[model samples]
Target: MQKDIELSGKLGKKRGNTKSKDCKTKTLILGCVVEKPATVGEIFKRTGFTGTYKSLAGMIRTYHDYGYLYRSGNKPFTYTISELGLEHLENPRLAREALIERRQANAVAVTRRFLLGMDEESRNNFLTEMGIQPVEQHVTIAKNEPAKPDKVTVKVLPEPVEKAKNEIKTNTRTEYVSRPEDLELIRELEEMLASVKEENENMARELAGRTIAKAENSTKKPPKVRNYDELLIRCKDTVVGSSFFNEVPYNLYVVIAELTKASMKELLKEKLDDVLGKKDFKKGRIVLVSDVQASALLRYKFVRKLKEEEYEKIKPKVEFRSDGVYIVVDRLHFADRMCDLPQIQRKSTPIIHHS
Candidate 1:
């Protein structure tokens, strides 16, 4: 019941001349992700309906494009609302109202996918760096809510139960008294919110020059590599500029397999997958050279592939970085034993040994 009320507010906000049945249906979907992000299958079942998965997915896609929602990778349960969406539930801000307006407008706009096509935080921070703060937002649920009325009454005429039942069955309409005073207050509140937006724009408008200067001035710390396990998780099949390459021997595929606990084919595929696009990754089989030899530009190719994939299912990206390189992707790892590469930059770097 409480959820229905919240959904009603979202739906009401989206109602406008361009309203569509699909948009209203989506307003009702906040309950699902608000509780926890759900897969397409779960959302359809949660709604207790069939034949609308595509529509729901499409709406989810649109929201994701706007950053009100997002998608996970290499697994199920892809859709999720951003923290901004949750905040929008509590604060009826301009961004939130704009999403509602856009939903209503159905004017068909294009939304950019996340930066480097990564998770929401990485993507958002990247956007913030670009000086294009994400504007898409949506209301989730507020801690405060209208108290439930103690009672509800239905006025009935002095008619027999049979007659009253028959009359209701036939459906007679009842008109409520018009309250222009209340309506006028709603108008004033709307105008006040708009005025506040105009004032804010005048105060803090950022130009492209400032945006570029800020980016140039910003210090993006070299992403510190965490524990081997964490890095392994993030870069499962993905590559980075700091991986092992040109370190493997042709005859040691078996030994390499044992160290990584993977088959020779799995290891080879991992290397190629790290180096190529979907097309290249799909064609995973490749010849092995005696030593791993891959290039920085190839590593860049792998990074751009992630950008292009954009929320599509991708294996956890994995790279081997030592003092030698900063983002060593498997695509850059030519041989099975590429992980054996010696330190080229710093002498104090530890080997990949876990107790």
Candidate 2:
């Protein structure tokens, strides 16, 4: 008998847990849109929600009817939680209790209707299964109250059945009654759902066309080689000069100086006599004083390993400015190595200023 009691306790606890989860359905739906507006698809993708899309959409529509959610566009309508919805999320006890009460009342109404539609024998069997004594037994027990105790063995209705009866008595509440405005909102929601369906079909066609185009382009073009070391060697060998003076560009030293935390002038201060050495430029510098000065004018980041697609099309190019000469490389390269920079905000400098 103790084992039976334990088993029943476990079953009852499982049922209660399920009931608790069911009561929080509205609260879960409202929580999904508390941070930002989201379509049903986006909410599922972001939250890893496992419910059916149609069921979620229906709940959102109901919340909108209650003014707990705001619906934005018609194309796959996005939902945002309203201020009232936020209030409900923070203190959901009252709302959850009311929902559970309404559900219980609705369940009783449905069961009563089903019993009324059944034959007498079927109705008796249904009530017996639910542990409810038939209506005839109630009459019999009242009549036999003064008789022997053995005759009063007919069981009384269980607690759930008694509760169901009380709920049915108070089931006249009209909280879910549809007003004219609600009907209008329902029509609009239906229209928006239909529009979303049409848009999805169009997007499918567009995606198929793009896939075919991509395949054809892939067949026409051969993939380019992307060797980081080879590119680095070529970039290092890049020389920039006029007929009057030809030499390796000074911009490379500027990049090395920036990496080593030394200024361009400091790096070249010892090497002045090597090429455009200091003797030629008044200072013992190999290049012009103007060129050395130009290198330190503007702050910029150096590009390292390029992404495959960028490597295929982009070649190293030198850009000249009044203040400095710098190399322009693929954006992805700079993005990949940006973390190495001491100040991350200096990742990229905007070349153009718009007023």
Candidate 3:
């Protein structure tokens, strides 16, 4: 019950909304060239990645875009972990923060797209549903219409008005008198109370039954990932929201698969079966991710495929220092989602790291 309340509050909080795809992969990628700069092919060979060379190259390029891996201007560029990337590799929290920031920015982009597509009433309704206060519009009076006086004012009151005011001031407040109760009225009240009691008893029994059912179905083990391609794509193929983009990190796919599983439906409070079609799932599979995981994933996916103009509106504000180093200010409204810690800037004077 407490967890459900926390989830409710988390969903309701209004927020103004990446980095490496996954922590382990990020660590591996960055770790590949910590000692020395290496070409993409060299890094690929070093990591012994099973995925295609093109995917590995793409991932490296994404890291470069985010200022994690810096490469040379020459052809067949050599990739090296930047100062920022080194710091991130050292502290897993930094990577988590970057991932969270990416998710938040994506959320902002997704929200903008959704709200822009909606009419004023529907947009306002959506905002209300998400617990965000809609922007209040000022009332404008028509130029041709006469303005009404806010209050009545008179230097000398009319006779009728003055008489009415006098009566109001002089009048005493009325008091209520109780009537003698009839037997029918007494019997009716008793019957109403009995009906209410019966309803309460029924509600209590229903609640107790639900509680027992939940307990019986609860499990302590973490959720196992099912092969989505085999289960969802090949068997029960249904395009729900957007086309399946394989570019999103493997870890995110695992999370989505785990959360959307039929076994997790009751725990996560979402039934993908309605949209994704029902499958016979094992009873009592433990759900590892929170209810908001799916929402975050959706937002991330949405922002990734945004139109150029739509993307520009919510993109991070990138500013450069005098030395040409860039700083990314995401400007997320929520405090928890934003990285509050001071970023250590690269010094103009370089210090050599002795091995």
TM-score for candidate 3, residues paired by index: 0.25
Candidate 1 positional error at 298, Å: 44
Tell me the tens digit of each residue's lDDT in model 2 across 1-355: 0111111112243455554544366566677777655666555444444556566666667878887776643334556777788887776666667678656655655555576699989976775686554433233323323444323233344357756565543332212122445456545644655564565568679999999998889766422211122223333325322311122212211221122335435535533223323222222111122222233322332212233443334443444333323344443242111001111111355699789
- lDDT head-to-head 1 vs 2, winner: 2
Error of 1 at 230 (Å): 12
lDDT of 1 by residue, 294-327 (tens): 2222322321112323212221233344422122
Locate the minimum summed-lDDT window of 10 residues in model 1: 248-257
lDDT of every predicted structure (CA atoms): 0.39, 0.44, 0.44
Name model 3 segments beyond 4 Å from true.
1-21, 92-355
TM-score of each: 0.28, 0.25, 0.25
Pick the TM-score winner: 1
lDDT of 3 by residue, 1-355 (tens): 0111111101124522222325656777788777756656666656766566677778789988887876642334556677788887897468568668656655655555566689998976776586544443333323333333431221233357756675543342222222224334434544655564565568679999988987887774222222221222221212221122231111111222333444444433432333223222222221111112334334433111323442244332222333321213244220111111112322376789999
Q: How do these models rank on TM-score, best leading?
A: 1, 3, 2
